[model samples]
Target: MNPKASPGHALSIIPREQHTISRKNISKAALRVLYRLNEAGYDAYLVGGAVRDLLLGGHPKDFDVATNATPDEVKKLFRNCRLIGRRFRLAHVVYGNEIIEVATFRGTSDEEGDRHVVDGRIVRDNVWGSIEEDALRRDFRVNAMYYDISDFSVRDYVGGMQDLHNRVLHLIGDPATRYREDPVRMLRAARLAAKLNFRIDPKAAAPFAELGPLLSGVAPARLFDESLKLFLTGHGLKSFQMLEGCGLLKFMFPATARAIRRGDRALCMLIEQGLENTDARISEGKSVTPAFLFAVLLWGEVRDLAHTWMSHGKDGNDAWSRAAAHVVSEQCQRVAIPRRFTIAMEEIWALQPRFEQIQRKKVFRLLAHPRFRAAFDFLLLRGAESQAMEELGRWWAHAQQLPHETLAAALPAQHVGGDVDTGVPAPARKRRRRRKPAGKSGAS
Candidate 1:
């Protein structure tokens, strides 16, 4: 065990038969990597999330290996291996569709290693050390355990087994220091707690309020990847609640936090329902898109902003457009949402007002739109906003079930050119008449 491991935490080794983990459960590709590394006289083990998930009887999608071999050495062992990462060098051993990630045991910064830090954050870490040091370097105690491939046993350096059994997440070292090293760990804490249905230890969660702002300094692109992990996973609603409880939501999604803070119960309902539906779809293995998820998350802000703009005498279309652009712009500054998803999000928002136009031509036009299905799904989420919105959603739902010709035949003949919500005609433009030329009036 590392001398610096938490006090009273000595190494605990659970023999192969003592634990539920079996080699058969692990991916064959991962096993091949582990066996090859061990045969090459390197200390190799299956580590981190794979071990934790297997212990809980869950099937992990990815398997990662931690070994004593350097990136170059690992590359030599397998011709298919490729080194990746600037912040933390790693080896990726590709096996057709699945890639097994192999990482070197991370050492402490105090040691003579090539680790770099800036403003308390680890910008680059290539340090290599013993397995004990690697365990200590992990973020959470539950993620610190290692599955030894040699003895077919498990090694615990920070009481990870007990913490895992108790369904609690405990940070490995000083909470604030670890969070500063990588603020994304704060988001990870919330995500893991929701994913595993575990409670975060108080000591681990205490620093979130102060350290959450550090996430702003992280790259928007990195945050975007983290956002997918938090929201796209099957436990999105739970993860969302966890983020809110930790008071970290504002740092990641300022617009969403602000909208929620306004006490719009309907808005909250809409967001929750959207997440629930997303979770359900994922559970059923149905395809999902980031565009729809983002549209739902940012809708409260866009709706409120558009209404505010319209109240200030802006055209309805202009108000909605500006509001969508502003919110998506502000959000991308933090999450770096790709332009593709942002464009789809905008289209979904722009379709809201059009949903109120039940005229035959407009209805058919909307039905044929590429974004119509996604936008219609978004409209259904707004049913929690009001009875009128609910009725509108129901109308569209019923319209989609009918044949196009039949639906067109059921629509009103006259087109109403004003805001659909208020049922008032738009202001009419005064016609300007052209003056006739005098054209030789004297001769006439």
Candidate 2:
């Protein structure tokens, strides 16, 4: 008898054939991982969104596997595996370009570890249990469905398959209590609704407004992760719309919410265009930058604040710098952008004034800037909103085609200084004031 398998245990159960009648489309990668685990004497099954998405005829962004094997056991089975996550220990198996995430089963908070509080938040976790217990602990019913490789059957512990068919997003257990466990689920509700085009069950939607504020208790880093998922994904426009409807956007980006509510049409159009552009680029396998995304999103707030400062007698450049700092700082309270993206944002903002000062060969120098393409893209977006600066955008497009000398000649003569050596112009020298006569002091 195998020592790991209990006497009379069903370890030798025949592998089940694929469920052809079911609509769930399993990925080749996920199937291989599941089979590999099962053949090694571990109880492995396909779990979470992968199963749900397959049932719904949608391709899951990623696949997750759950098994009865302990984290240590799972690590020992795969040579390329690395154990990760402090809150929820899981194994990541690197298979060249693809990665397979395997998580052990978790039970209720009362089963193993004592509950503890961290910064006024209760973290009830660390228990390991049967797969059924793990299923019950998941966030959403649709995400709790599991695919049993042994029986080729889909397990509906929380009616996940039913909820998926119903086109509804329902909380796994109690709505409010589950939110208390992890408030990011509320944001996930919005993301799923937008991404899958599913409706939130009335019970689930009901608690969102009252429980939305719970998100503030979450760590800034986690909030940052969710913010990217909410706004940078292809469905950002729709997710934002849903978030606004639920009164959740205000907590994440108060300034942006205020601008949107204040009828900032320019800002709205720019955001829509930027999201559309990002989605298109992503679909084409092109690279996208978070800094550019943030810069465009916050541009309206920055412009509004800067204009207000300029209205109060500050120079445009000075007002812009102050307003950029103020706006970025305010946003950091929610998203906690890293220093690199923050620096990129500053560069993007600092280039705006240079856009207006496009004269002489300075245009080429501006073009050489690391953020020039993004800045120019933003400029075009602003023109789309303001309409008044349409010619500026056209000029930029036209200048791109011209040779260096031709581009230089198009600039105004007044801006063409003599050379780099003598930075000051003759006009500036002539404007200097003369010293007062000493006779005036004697007369006094």
Candidate 3:
């Protein structure tokens, strides 16, 4: 019933099939929740990237609904609904198997007080608005598409359909203002471009270079969330290419940017292979951890630091430890790594030195370690990247497949090297190195 969001002649007159788009690919849980809301008299429509993806003939990972009902009202209607987020309120309707996120249409803040405030380098995004306002509030035109169940017509307030047809990523409204509102949008632009294999609209691409610094203002936690969507998602390598192409890569990973710009093909290969492995694992419904992904991304940088530390006479283990510590700290400043993942990353890094130990008992002990599997996978990734150390990676892989009893026999025996013997053949000159007892021991 939002007057501002009323359909135009073209949209209103569009065919029902165009508006009442098929939810065949959408989850039954989502359909049930959305339809139930509609039946209960709250205006609900399928919106955002889910609709965009569906229109492109691709299967959306999830479904989202934009509704006129507030978060509290939505919760009252569904027992499964749980309210989440404070900045921008949202309702997560749990379907047991899946979650259908329901977000009320957002509007710009025009409150009496300051709407935008900067906390050091981070922006606190707490804005509310109408459906029309929400449609225009999105980062991209294609992302703003809405499928109305009322008349089964698609609404295009921002020319999203045209951009979708042209396979272009277009910014909604003024690019600069929108980028200023949320810098994460810049990263999202690159992500969507890579994900859809679409070119960014020229206007959308214009302010990205100048507005790139705004990304630093985004919360590390939010950056962490977006980073997962970018790298851990199936199109990770492609997203990296777009990020680099648009100069957005440095904001997230300054070291990787430097390496790529320096034309370090080895570093590039390592990242690419890691992404490929991650993608393959994801496609197979296997689990992939963020700690492992970040570890791989920072591996090249870790190697450089390790080499520098080694030149100062530090041992491989110490050098690697120092490098991993520095890399993890630097990354956390950009994206807050939870203590859980950070601990895992540290354990994974600590395992590298022991990888070469090859002692049967030691190897077995390491394999028993929780992080061994992730670190071992990382080693295999490195082997895939370059010809160097291929033998070592393969040897570990072969050894891992052995039965416990066989593995113990296959690995080298522990502690075969000699130790220096420092012996006192006779009594020491100074009181035979005896400790003083009260006031008489030294003299005795």
Question: Evaluated with lDDT, which candidate comes out highest?
Answer: 1
Give the alpha carbon lDDT tens digit for every residue of 1-444 in model 1: 334555679888899999999888999999999999999899899999999999999999899999999999999999999999998999999999999999999988556778888988999999998888899899998999899899999999899999988999999889999999999999999999999999999999999988898999999999999989998989999999999999999998999999999999999998999999999999999999889988988998999999999999999999999999999999999999999999999999999999887677787899999999999999899988888788778778877777866766657654654333322223444557866677845455
Better candidate number, 2 or 3, judged by TM-score: 2
Candidate 3 has an lDDT of 0.76
Cα lDDT over the full model 2: 0.75
Q: Lowest summed lDDT over 10 consecutive residues: which window, candidate 2?
A: 419-428
Q: Alpha-carbon error at 183 in model 2, in Å?
A: 0.8
lDDT of 1: 0.90
User: How far in Å is the alpha carbon of 137 misplaced in model 3?
Assistant: 1.8
What is residue 358's positional error in candidate 2, in angstroms?
3.7
lDDT per model vs. reference: 0.90, 0.75, 0.76
Task: State TM-scores per candidate.
Answer: 0.93, 0.84, 0.82
Q: Over all chains combined, what TM-score does candidate 2 have?
A: 0.84
Q: Write the per-residue lDDT of candidate 2 for residues 1-444, one digit (tens) a residue.
A: 522222222222222343331424666666777888899888888888777777666677688999988888888888889999777778998777777899888876564554454643456455787776787778887787677776677666656656666888888777888787788888899999988889998898888778888887777778888878876767777887788888888877788888888897777888888878887887788888889888877888888899999999999889989998999998887888887998888888888778666555566689889789888887787776644466667667667777877766556544543322112112322345767797676454
Better of 2 and 3 by lDDT: 3
Misplaced by over 4 Å in model 3 are 1-13, 18-20, 108-130, 358-368, 384-386, 401-444
Clashes of each: 0, 1, 6
